[model samples]
Target: MSEHRQLPAAPPLPDPPPRPKKRQPTQDEITKARLKFLKEMSKHYITNEENIVAKEMFRLHKYNWPQILVVTAGCEGESDFVTFSSDEVLRVDREFNYQCVLARDRVGRIISIPLDFDIKCRVVSHDKASEKQFIANIIESHSLPVTVKFAVPDNHIFDLGESAHRADSFGCMALLKVYDETYLISNPLIDGVLDPHIIIIPLYLEMLISTVVGAEAMSVKEWEEYTEEVKKDAAKLDFSSVKGRKAMAIYPDIPDEAQDTDIYSYIRPDSYVILREKETGRIPKERINYCEIYKCDKDENVYEEITPSVPPRAPQKKPCSSKSAGPPIPKRDKSSTSTKLPPARSDVSDLTVAELGEKLKLLKLDKYVKKFEKEGIDGSILVEMDQLILKKEFHFKEFEAIKLTKFVQSGHIPS
Candidate 1:
């Protein structure tokens, strides 16, 4: 019998379908209210480098992977990595598996690549050194030509066991180090730790990883230029000054690490609170009142008293409500076929119990709106009220009041 002959054939691989073009909203498609609200909130950390990471990542990646849902901060232990939305591994071939990549910058190189299945990705740094050095080491190990260095002052002083820095102390800035290679070099530790809560850019780095890194490594010159451009872009940022004065201040009580919940929440939009020894520099999620903020400047501090509930604009005496200002609709004869219209209640304060009930029937507050309504009891009188509790100290009596204030400011409501 002839010996069996086998032909060596290449293994087959699954080709993922072509990705759809990302849907961009037209000017008409955008909800103006939502866009405006987002713009207001983004003013807090828009220029933060870490915060910009998420936007950069999405711009570089997510458009091609529609099924991938990006959650900014993971909710639980299970929330680590770019796991499949369905929580199942997608097999591309025998050696390659679908995975989430975390891309970010350390010193200078755009650290973009998929983490291996065997390796558990994490962030770590010594009490005396910046995390940037550790990240830079990882990049250098990848055969990428990025130089890394850490500066150690004569003595690096950190408040013992706390995240607050000693106010007005150059000792805090001593930990800042410089890292450079043929491709990228500079410092990212400017006064505060580049942690997750203060900056959501790591999420962006995750997105960029799938875009910039591949089988063909980037050239050192290209990498250097890219980092230089990023540095130039950052240099243009002017967050260290408030009205031309330097932002740093020293309060005798503000330790190198402070845990004032109110101050944490307030400064969060501008920078993150890095409580020493805490896993992440995030404020405790519990609802903390504004009074807890111990030491803060007026510009950087957030307090409760600033937000107040608005009252109904001194009951606008409308022409329709004023008896002498308008012609009233003719009253219908009792036996006539025409429908009789109920009279509007212009004076709620002077209304009788029966009349108040009749007027309240016309003012229908929806179930959601009723959540804010308070029924005040002053014996034999029903005082129906609606309020918006803005801060611990501020409460608005009605939505109408809020609207009226804006209207007046914008000239929509006559003074």
Candidate 2:
């Protein structure tokens, strides 16, 4: 009643304004996410002058702390940078969190660096743009000096410059060859955008690297020596058993009768020959037969006969099957490396089952080993068959093509 008068009915408590209908956002499509990121980064660097503000923005964007990892691209002769092994780089996510620093180059190779260690770098343009006005703005904002200027001569048409003119193109970077990719980081109209891959190198690091390279320049003499050394190594034959000054000699294995007929048997003094002699100019008169195959050269003190299995002019046998039990292997006569001793099948009588299997492996008849066991051909009978083949005096070639085939099929040597 106190002057209330219904308070004008409280102005009828104005009806609450109709709630605005929530908007269904129209989505923004990103055709090239890489391009978008590159644009944003370029713009950000061009606009932001303060490092603190820029770095804070970087943090807001959830970017990792900057780092550097020097990687070797190709072997020494192929690449311009100092040729180092690629193994120097640690594997990504291999006990360390890291990612590629830049986009792939024209070659589509991207390099990654670890966040655990901080390495300095220099950011220099690949001499892409030369327009003074265009570069002045970039230098003012980003503080990166244009190391190279992309040239378009007056006679050349600008049409061909389109690819190189892209916002993110393969421009030469000072420290690393980075692939040029622009990722879509943010769109005002889109949600759930990816973070941009940003690679920025510091100035000091580039200078440091340049200095180091300048100091390590290769001299002409050093280069020549390296070339000669490589050529020498390329010309020499490589053998495992014959190392250093030691050599392997393959004599003609000529029968005394063939000595006159075979061209290889024509002896020349004062020249190298497989047969040992007192001196290089000397030759055995009539193939002197003795306990030692090497000629007695006590004065010259050349190769001393170490193994009894060797002939004076025998070719050294290479260690077979990548394994050897004792001293040098006993030499066998054959035209090829695949030859194995054809002990009389009866000789297997003395060998155990293990020894028999090993011998079969050396002969490259391993496929028949299990077959022997499957057919219940014990060591004794196996040895007997082997002796029969040996008694026939069939060398490796005859054994492989004829005797071994029958042995594998029938599980016994034919009488």
Candidate 3:
């Protein structure tokens, strides 16, 4: 017989309702959220400061404790201000390690979280004998201290037009030479002067834009064209637009000439440009802000409502061990014995960034290596140093490859 009649078709399933789309936040809402976050951060910072002061009072007796002061000086004729106060400023001495941490990381929540900008200063009892002992102990222990002093310039000074142009693109800029002086050039330069003493953290794009606009005026169209030409000149480079969201998309195109050169030619790639402000002579002092920062031990004791603070002293040494010390290991000489330690690794001081990068790539360590190798470092030293400095100084999350590629294209390395 014929197959049984097909079962009644299953009832049609209800069409799934379309998912509701989430509404995007309005600009005002976004701004309000950011402001709220900043306020919360301010509260946290205040709490941290209070806790630090309390601990300092407990650790150092009121009579012998260190005092910290933070000051900011405005341009000439403007009043100086205390931006922030802290007694435990040196408690975060470990934060100094953050400098190395930041070099390798993308902008993180730490930077996004606003903080009160304050310069930290400490008063120390400058005893030559005590200070000498302290420094010697730190050096012997290979520890970086929080209480070193350097002579800063009597006052911060800058050429108005030049400083303004330097800051025009970045809202603020600083020039710190090998000597201790640091010149700060700040926002909205009028007649080439910083109008205020407040340390304003410029917006991110503001910095980039400042860098771009401060340079010679070139149309966006011109930039695109120039980029195209640069790509053509760097034959080894392939053109590609940076992926994902960014304020600006960097188009990497290598020209033909650049391609023929070895990839290790550039150690420090130049990512931004600077242009001199056209000026016949220096602007008058009236147009610029000149200020000076005093040299202060960041870990000295000073008068405070809380207990006094003591200078960081050397660790007291323990008495000599009662048990006999182990016998010293004799040094080996290859001339007299067949067994010899492996030859010392090559010094990395002379290796260019590109060359080190190539070795890193060969070793499949590119993921950990950065593109900005010291121009004089040696590749062997990198492997020998166990890539400590490289890992600490140059690791980039998303842009590691980009930085390496850019370095190759820049051709700034020695032959």
Candidate 4:
């Protein structure tokens, strides 16, 4: 019995044959998995009304060629109905369904179609027919009991150019507002369609508008911040003024004669601030070289080495009067002015939120104390605050922004 022993424990059972290594998935398999997940998610989010509409539309036009009437507006505010075949609409819907899945996944919530997509239809009423009539016709023709309304909430229309520029990079999609919920639909036609539009129906005159079109593909908090920013921008009188405006320069050196002309200042990659005329499209060479040029930094420290071609002129001294002036005043040398920036204070950048609030109070900007504290802005963020951020993000007035900017740039926080 003792001789039977262990027999070397049966050679460890050959390690269970390595379990076949669980085969790594290929890229194609991974893509298919992702698409399957997106498809399931999109199906889960699609409303019953949308499904009914799709089914009825397809059924009604099964024998006859289907045509979708899309209400569109041109740049001149002129409106018309653009017709699309059933095949085209279905193709666009397929693409839009894919986009909705991606947007929902990225945003972690159901959102309207992103503004990156072309406009499909509008919720506004046309001269020929109102949204109510349109929905009434569809309901009567299909004999379906679906209700909708056109009184869209939050009458805020986003700036098309800005919204498109800020919207996340994604494929094209359309918009549809059924009853109170707005969804992304698909349409491929670019012409005759407004850049950003929504479709709605009128039953109770109450509707939910899609506010996610212009969103920057951020978190919920970020989206709220962005919407507030858009509202503030829309409310401001200078919103249109800032559009299409940019800092640009045609020449390295700007002449004195061009000083009176409207000019824009730009920060160079090397930290030098260069001045250029506002209209830099085409300018005469004579206007550009009319005077000596110089550059400056963010601290307004002027550097004269920008134009080496121009010779330095000697400063002219006025002749002294014969009569003795009561104690001759000392002349200040402009060349001797300090080019160094103010020293940074460690305490200013290390201040807590409470201390930052106190500093704001000292600066007579206590009104923003609540906002700062709510946003958890401490000394580190305070040090980085600028006029644009204060105005755009915090909704500060022009004077308030200027004052805050000065306070931050001074680097001297009061105790």
Against the reference, the lDDT scores of all candidates come to 0.25, 0.27, 0.24, 0.31
Instruction: Arrange candidates, best TM-score first.
Output: 4, 3, 1, 2
Off by over 4 Å in 4: 1-344, 411-415
Candidate 3 lDDT over 147-176, as tens digits, reads 322111222111111011111222111111
Candidate 3: deviation at residue 92, Å? 14
Please tell me which model should have the higher lDDT, number 2 or number 4. 4
Residue range 119-185, candidate 4, lDDT tens digits: 2222222333234333324333432222222222221111111010111122121122222112223
lDDT of 1 by residue, 245-282 (tens): 00111222234377232231112111112111112222
TM-score for each prediction? 0.17, 0.16, 0.17, 0.19
Candidate 2 lDDT over 1-415, as tens digits, reads 5674443334457789999999764444343663464344322111112222212332333343111122222122111111223212211100111121211223322212111112222234443343433222333445322242223222111100000011122234322211121111110111112222212211111111100010022355743453354334333422212111011112223344753311221221111112222112122233211101221111111212233332222222221101111233344234433323344445455556676676666655555567555555555655345422432433232224334534433444333
Output the better candidate (2/4) by TM-score.
4
Worst 10 residues of 4 by lDDT: 73-82
Q: Model 2: what TM-score?
A: 0.16
Alpha-carbon RMSD to native, per candidate: 26.5, 32.5, 28.0, 29.1
Best by lDDT: 4
What TM-score would candidate 4 get against the native? 0.19
